[model samples]
Target: MNTLKWIKRILMALLLIIFLLLMAGFVFERISRSIAEKIKPDGQFAEVENHKMHYLQQGKGGPTVVFETAFDPAGHLQWYHIQQNLPKSYTTFSYDRSGILWSERGANPKTGEKMAEELHTLLEKSKAPKPYILVGHSFGGMLTRFFVQKYPKDVAGVILVDSQYPADEKYLSPQLYKMVNQGLPGGFLKFANTFGAARLMFKNMFPENNQYQYQNSVMPALLYKSADATLEEQDHMKSVKTEAAAINTFGSVPLYVITAGDKTKYDSFIKDQKIKNEMLGAWDKMQKDLLNLSTDSKQIIAEKSGHYINQDQPEVIEKAVNDMVEKVSVQ
Candidate 1:
């Protein structure tokens, strides 16, 4: 009789704890949504296929500079510093991908081709004049490459900033590759977003300036809309490589490849210098190969920087884009 009573009491305590957690999660979610609503979007919107796409544009003229964000969910905000420094004579633009901050969730699969098509449409709808100079960072580089391949006539030049090579997986060890490709758990993110846990976690760690406000506003939205889309994009990695292989070259269309200089952190996760060196070598070789993509291409090493060159050395990106703009202007 005593044992039965104790068992019942323990079971009841467990149930109560679970109930409290669920309730707390619900309350946090409500608080997060309210905070998100108070934040204003940084840019204007363009309607594409009846969905609103958010974008920011500065300056005013021909051969518009279009910036694409890295794989990180922050979107156009990643280029905030570099974009601000560009000349006012030439138009510059940046935008969030579908399912990212300030953009409607897209129904189509998040493949490189689909993203490129959507970007093309967004520009057309937004009335961004043609003869564009596409500047892409990281995964955005792949999308920009796809855009150039599909609409070669519209693009005057390309700048890839610490971009992801299509065959990147081939250079990675099997263990590393598996770790890189493994998808984050969407359900956990969704739960965290619902409970405002993600918001609290990132609020303090956000970058300086006005970035904290931006990050706080969009962190939950990204968790809610982008978690699954990110996974879906990962699944299509092979297809991205295949498409890249098919394009082979970019002809003489003025390409600049900016590679990161700091390689000491490459294998920090595993704390293995050998693995890090190998990965860094592969990355350098890949960046060099990017030169083969264009007859007029060159590679610049951001000697003081890492993968996030825009943040580490915004001046480097500024110079590269300025140079590309000058090159296109003459041609």
Candidate 2:
């Protein structure tokens, strides 16, 4: 009788422990994050094409501007400051492309025209005033050209911020080609995988960067986006990526390319010296390619910045953007 009693007690204790752990995990996984609650982002949400998209809008008037972000989940977040600072002189639209923030998760490789097509639809749907300025940063910058080609009549101007060019592919050293052509995940990705790393990164250790660096609340969206990019549809992207390569190879675009003149911190993650050099080399390509893109184009080198140029130098980008905006007005 005593032996039976001890076994029963032990089993009961084990069961209780299991129950508690389950409850804790459930709480952690299901609970909404604090940051998600912080900003309402004041934009219309839509079930666009294969996925839902969250787009924020502010200001009012001519030159309706649309912002496309780099391939990050919280891409819209990167432009928060710039959006706030720009004179609502023209209405601005910043959206979470496909699998990005607040947007429903879905499969999509996210080609330039496909993305631009969605924006094309978004433009028609929003019924926002016409003559749009399609401004892209990094990958977003590439899309600006793609959008202009697809909707030649619709665009008023374009701004490329320290962005990749149509010819960026030509300069793609074998190493950089593996990184971008393979279309891997963004650099700060690990920051989303761990709580401790996220803490260090979110402390603004990186500028113009959201604190949720390691904690990607938007990954489900990325996975789905990558999964859904159809190969046939990607044919256009091949040309787009190729044009980017050619642009880099020969240099082209009625462009403004901002090069980050800063060096990487060369810590553990930063230890990838080959990667560091390749990225810098590619950065140099922006200047060369833009000159190739347009005779009247200008290249501004931003000092003390990383791949995330606008984050570190928003004022610099804003001034650059304003200059581009004014230049477009002149054109």
Candidate 3:
């Protein structure tokens, strides 16, 4: 009877500790979220299918440049420098997709086509000047393909910045691909974030630079809905690849492909030199293949940069967009 009583007491104490930790985490999460809302940068919101989507727009007038972001929750951060430096005479727009950053979570099965449609609706509602010069990075490249294919009329030209190759899976080892896609499960991530684990882990990781500080400030909150959204995107990538492959060419549409030229960037992810070399070769081929999308297309290598050409070499993107804008303006 004494032994049994001791075991029972220990179990009860453990349960109580867990409950208290959960409550504390929940409280901290709520407080952080509230504070983040108050201090974060202001962005316009649009209702898309009963959920709010957040967006930032700079400059004004015709030939709008619409930026599509990669897998990160803070999507707008990808284009901050370029968007700010673009000519004020031309409009530039970037947004957090559904369930990312300030945007509210939406319905499930967030496929590429569905997202493209949502973007169209957002554009219609926001009244952003249309027939845009579309710019996409990483996963956003896949989205840009869907957008251009579904709403070809809304696109004047395209600029792919170190974009995801639909066939990337074939090049990368299974381990690397899984590592890249299968980040902590969305449910666990949300739970962890809600319980303040994510916040606690990354609180000190924020950059000191004021320009980018606010961008990183919102990350702890991002792992909630955005993690699920990212997983959904990864789960449905096969369909995305199939849909993107349907477009054999863009005909006369002006296209610019900015390839990240640093082959050594993958060295960290891949150990075997032989496999890394093969992957690098495949990447180069895939980038060059993007040029075939349009006869008017061109490719510029960001030799100093890795996957993030915008951050490493913003001038390459700015010059490409400016040149595309001029080309489209004449036509």
Give per-model CA RMSD. Answer: 2.6, 7.1, 3.3
Query: lDDT per model, in order?
Result: 0.78, 0.61, 0.79
Q: Which residue pairs overlap in candidate 3's backbone?
A: none
* lDDT computed for candidate 2: 0.61
Residue lDDT tens for model 1, 1-331: 9999999999999999988988897887776666666668878898776778889888888778999987766777777667778898988989888877778876867777888888899888777777899988888887777898889999999999988887767677787667655656656766766666765555543455563465545654455455545555666766876786667688788999999998664655647777667777878887888788899999999998878888788899999998888888997
Worst 10 residues of 1 by lDDT: 203-212
> Best candidate per TM-score, number?
1
Question: Tens digits of per-residue lDDT for model 2 on 272-330?
Answer: 77787776676576556566555556677778776677666778877866666676666
Which of the two candidates, 2 or 3, achieves a greater TM-score against the reference? Answer: 3
Stronger candidate by lDDT (2 vs 3): 3
